[model samples]
Target: MGSAAPAFYGRRVPLFFNPLEAAAHRLSIAPPMFDYFNTLGLHALVAAARLRVFDALRERPSTADGLATTLTIDPRTAEVLLRVLAGLGYLRVKGGRYRLTRTSRTWFTTDSPTSLVAGLEFWERTACVIWPRLAEAVRDGSPVTPFYELLESDAALSRSFQAWTAALARRQAPATARIIPVPRDGGHVLDVGGSHGLFSVELLHRHPGLRATVLDLPQALEAAADHPRLTLRAGSFLDDDLGEGYDVALLFNIVHGLDDQEVAKLFARVAAALNPGGAIVIGDQFRDSLMPGRASRTLLDLLDLNYRVATGGRVRDFREVARMLRAAGFDRPRHRRPLRSVVTELAVAVVKSPSRP
Candidate 1:
């Protein structure tokens, strides 16, 4: 009787053959669902960060109830989130307690020098909202919400954006300083669109004789660190008059946000700002230069899409940049020696003569 056949809609079916169970088995054996549900993971991570769950774990390993009491969340929900994070490798469970993993301890903790909390906050606040409009941007041939316009409208978001970029810049500046040469005779260095001024600061440290001026929007300068050798000028690099007689100039991570004409104009401006034989370094992710099947290439490709949706910017290859530099009256552009930590390639050009206005 236990192995008897069952009737399903007037048809005899084997008792062991359950349609729902078979369907579930098929779905489980299909390709992993993680890829399809990646957004869920990202949102969970963002929520955990915002709730300071990692910070709580940093103090001591705790069970879900302990976390709930500490963070003022429901125990069941806390348990679910902790379990998800543990699966994501940011946390681990041992002895009935959830603890931050090494990766989370270093990056999620507020006190850590390399902490990414600010960056994550900015992403959660701004980028997450903007990314959903990528399709609209593609359809309209421009960003639905312009990056600068978004920053200008929201003061709090603007500050977070600055801090977020500054954190990344601080990490990259040391490697950037190593690749680019600074003038030995205490020449002026102009940093165009230098939001946080960390790159200028790093260069100043490497070349003690160098004095640098950072030119960017006033709001962007709010988070920049002050140094005796560094002067912060608050204005748009495109609209503002860049003071002349600079020996070296940097345009790090900026060109992708401009059109071809704008890049040429920017190069012309840099050329004019430089003294004869002064060097101009353009640092950006050149799509053509990236190797195939590499993680950096994929990262840059996504970043290129981001710029397209956010700023009407298109990431160009090194050849395209070189063409623009030449049109602006600079000498042939050459790739600077690669730095380990700097994924963006550096292209250098020199002013032999003043660029025609």
Candidate 2:
């Protein structure tokens, strides 16, 4: 028999990653041959975030040399990075001094309620590790290991994800609260997988008679704020006791992370838990619902692929969601775009009751 070539994946792939060198290249994009698999353009921003470049600039406009002294970076190096950030539109440069652009102030500072800084950390520390093995997930039609399993083991990665989720929730919750059809008479809501509990808080503020329970895993609920009307129920929405007779069940950004069978089961469970005439509002990125060439069409498709790689899940169309809901005893569902967001929309269904009929 001819000698077999050395195997590719079953053994150690040589790692050229140097933490110091990676840190040294902090202000620049890693060369194409960079050790980790981060996407190209993002590395520049990641480097700046890591170096707290945005934070320093936010304090006051500063020349490269001044920032270098404050940040303990070499002046020459800081100049190059500052110029790059300005070019990237994250900062503005004039009079040899750099300062935060509106974009940076809104989304980069850690203190900003909608800050996306943790997004970079999640991508670098968690998502990149999953990307290299994405092919296996695709070919197998499931994630090699589900996303939460990985997070369960890595506290740092989990915290980064939680922070990102919370920031995103803060941006979207108010709009969602406005759009969601809370019962007019004021009843209970089941906020399924409501990790950050921002939605529940918003709903309670909007409707005085509304009481909400945010059901999610215990770890995800750690940062969830307590409210007299908002109960944090730590458990699985898939297998655990979801209390019955909820007036509204909000499944936001959830279904894309579950398989079809799991979605069907969960929908049935949701059906059983809702009161007569109660509505279910599912907020998610539906790939088929986006118009062709829409601004967020690509983002929706990317999320579909990302979900596939992370949880054996894929995006569903409004039709698919409606069919599942109908099978679970809901009336025909309506797809509504309530938020200014192009990607996330709601598919709402109501449990039929004799009074409503």
In terms of lDDT, the best-performing candidate is 1
Ten contiguous residues with the weakest lDDT in model 1: 6-15
- Per-residue error (Å), model 1, residue 171: 1.0
lDDT of 2 at 81: 76
TM-score of each: 0.86, 0.85
Predicted candidate 1 versus true structure: per-residue lDDT over 155-265, tens digit per residue:
788887787777667667888788776777789999998988988998998888899999988778888889999999998877778879999999988999887777878
Question: Model 2 — TM-score against the truth?
Answer: 0.85
User: What lDDT does each candidate get?
Assistant: 0.79, 0.78
Measured with C-alpha atoms, the lDDT of residue 301 in candidate 1 is: 76
- Model 2 Cα displacement at 309 (Å)? 0.8
Candidate 2 accuracy as lDDT: 0.78
Best by TM-score: 1
Instruction: Report how far off residue 106 is in candidate 2 (Å).
Output: 0.8
